[model samples]
Target: MAVRARAARTGVYQYAGREIDPDNTHGLRDTAVVNVLRDESAVFDERAVRSFIGKPITDDHPSQPVTADNWRTHARGTIMGAMRDGEYLAFDLMLTDAPTVAKVNAGKRELSNGYACDVEIGDFTAPDGTKCQARQKPGSIIGNHVALVDRGRAGSDCAICDALPSNLFDTLKTEKPVKTMVIDGLTVDMANADTAIATVQTLIAARDAATGKVTTLEAQTVADAATLVAKDAEIAKLTKALADAKPTLQQLRDAGKAFAVIEAKAKANGVAVTDAMDEAAIMKAVVDKAMPGNTYEGEHVRIAFDALTKDTKVDQPKVQPIGAPAQITDAHTDYLNDRAKQRAALSSAWKTPFNAADAA
Candidate 1:
């Protein structure tokens, strides 16, 4: 599994410069210091000693061991004077007993492309339960550890040192912000910042347009669904109306038979029936002619006609009465004689012998 680096704390001031530590409690007193302006022989000068009782030695002087009496007079005076004068010169802290030259080389090795050495500035609680200002500069391992540079005394503040910017803007001003951008497998060198920004804007505009088109399609789909629902409702209404207006099978059969009877009656009265005449028209014509000189209403006449014809017998082929005897033919007489002979044989008490003559 890969571990992601956590974001650094906020409100922690950062400086892209060196810092100075005056504390000698961590066995860092013998750490070598150098004077940049002097020759190699003056690198370990007495004034470069780590500190004289928590104070930095700024001026080169003869070597003198730190004593209780001189600690306050010499070491404390020099550092306090510098602070009062507002001298915010860059300084280095003897944080470890490592060789000074090696540490410097290590700091240089940690510098990478597009990055610079920086220090994180913040307040820290000292062993004496007092708040002290501290500076943490990048070590040789970059993010692994940091070298602490503490200002002498608690509550000592340095606004100028803590206000340095730690971003890459200063370094990038002399170089291009971006080197290359890969688009569709094609590498494009971002030589101009304006052109790169314009490309991003174009991509954003196209995405917005496509999103708008998708939204429109969704809206159209909803509208089409509503239209289908309305059409279904209309079809249902039409279906019901058709069911109410059209006659059923049984109703059609009854009306057709009644019309047939009315046509026959019209024909019997010497009236000609035509295909153009419907049941109502024929009934009206017949009722008017049959009831001539009578003040009978058409509705009453139709009712009487229907009642009279309701059980009227239909003409059928004549059939013989069930009690009438059937006429006998020669074949029937022979059949009767054969039946009589069988009855006589059955009635006899003795069994007859089988003979061809008897069969004849």
Candidate 2:
């Protein structure tokens, strides 16, 4: 493994370009002393930098050293987001367990890193030009976990921060009163005032457009409901009318059937009915065809039509055809001869004179 280069250090951390304030009682000799122990700085050499970069963050240092086999059971979260704040490695701790988060929020602010290294007791100079008695072997440093504690080995300098130091933002020079707005639960703090205003306006316009579409949908729903009510009322009225007229329909059907039968019988017997005739006219024609010369009126026409029903053969009445006649019978020839002799004797008596017949 190659030795890695470390970041430069200044032996103390500041609230960086911000004004210093005095603490009431947080256990510190000075107000801004983030001391990284000037003489014994070998703990943060190049070996420590590589080993501690991606270590896990825990509530407290476990009794046993954390390893890959047991890290899952011991790890609350990782502190891989380590930034070198001078000689002290400033890392962010996010406890995965709810109880640990509550404890940290309730004033557990200090952090201590648990690591193993081969310390060679000798007169040696650290990479930052700080002379020290114990020097850690370049390849013998191994990081386990950075733990939250009541007080760290490095004092309050290695601690959890409630908020970022104000000096991190060099853009606070603007005189815009430092505006802050929230969009969908996200706080929007920008460097430029004009950019912030434009963002707020665009978000508000999108919200208003969504509200308008919701209103349109609600109005369309009401209109569809009203149309359904009117259609239901029309259907109900039609259904009732149909029910009320049901009683008379059977009688009308029976009359229609009888009329059809009479018309059919007349047509079969050589009568042609046309649409020009009404019901009564057609019935009268039917009666005339059946009886040839008889006529009926009033209710008697109906009675005559009923009598013809018992005999459908009235439609086929016998009649002589116009063709050569057949020979006459013997009885019919004798009767014709007797009628001629009587007519001859009556003529002779009249010729003998009425005076001579009286004297005899």
Candidate 3:
């Protein structure tokens, strides 16, 4: 075969305006290192190489060694050995055992197109009538256990077991039952096919039993029930407290009326009574309005009242007269005055009106 003239001793060449010398030793290197940029279909062989370099080499057009890009396709078969001389830079190309690369490309394609092949299942066997170990088409079968190997395929150093989909299994179940099997160089049991079937059945039963014990939905229902019970208990406790306090609230209502009467008298006199005023304000107002004689000013009110009536009932209902006001303005004024007097009197009292004894 006619070989192309070897590249310049410098091995450094310009391509697309960029100077490149592989490994930076162009001065010592006698041959050039040129990359192959041929498409997969380009044929590279002896005759192909001669045809490419038919023109005579010249000063302006020096002979360029056959780089992988311009080499005949067949040159790939011996590219590895050719690298020893550094005469050419060609890729040692082969498609054998390249499933991982295929898988990566397939993932990219799937992501771009939003489509994927459904998984298939089936039993795979080897050429020697044995099961092949997992490795591409040479490895796992996608959905079915069946593999289709065309004639003259190479690279049988590794094999593998591929799981196929159930649909494919239904179709291939009667295909001679795939008699040969291998697990890491171990043979399948010859007389224990029945045991294998039983083992699968036992595993199925155990999984079902586990699924029946506690389900996600059931757990959610249990949590909801606990929350409802707690809320109902809280509501019932509040209801009981309100029921127990009803009578005491009613008693305070009755006692608050007598205080309101005294408050009305103080307001009628143009005095600005306040809620902060104590029992002293009430006694003062009563003494001022009554303008009691020396018999009352020097003497305590309790003693004067006691002398006036010995049979006075201390616990008489002290309801304020309902005719205190007819209009809203009058009612508001009455409320303000009454609150002021109540605050003062209650402040002076040893106990608050809210206390149990005061309510009684």
Q: After superposition, how far is residue 80 of candidate 1 from its true place, in Å?
A: 74
lDDT (tens digit, per residue) of candidate 2 on 185-287:
7567765567776776677688879966765564455445434655676678789888767757787877666667777766765778998876677778877
What are the candidates' C-alpha RMSDs?
Answer: 46.0, 43.8, 40.8
Error of 1 at 70 (Å): 99
Query: Please, what are the lDDT tens digits per residue for candidate 1 over residues 1-360?
Result: 000111111122322122222123333324453111211112122332222113322112213433333332322111111111222212222211224224333432111011123322344543345443443332311211111113321113321121243643233443545677875454556676686557656665777799778656654554455356557767887899899688899988787777777887777666688999987667666666655654444455565455434544544335667897887679889999999999897988367667888789
lDDT of 3 by residue, 24-95 (tens): 233312333322121111122333222322111111111233222332321211111111113331222111
Top of the candidates by lDDT:
2
Identify the candidate with maximal TM-score: 2
True-structure lDDT of candidate 1: 0.40
Candidate 1, residue 95: how far the Cα is off, in Å: 67
lDDT of 2 at 38: 28
Cα lDDT listed for each candidate:
0.40, 0.58, 0.34
For each candidate, give its TM-score against the true structure: 0.20, 0.35, 0.17
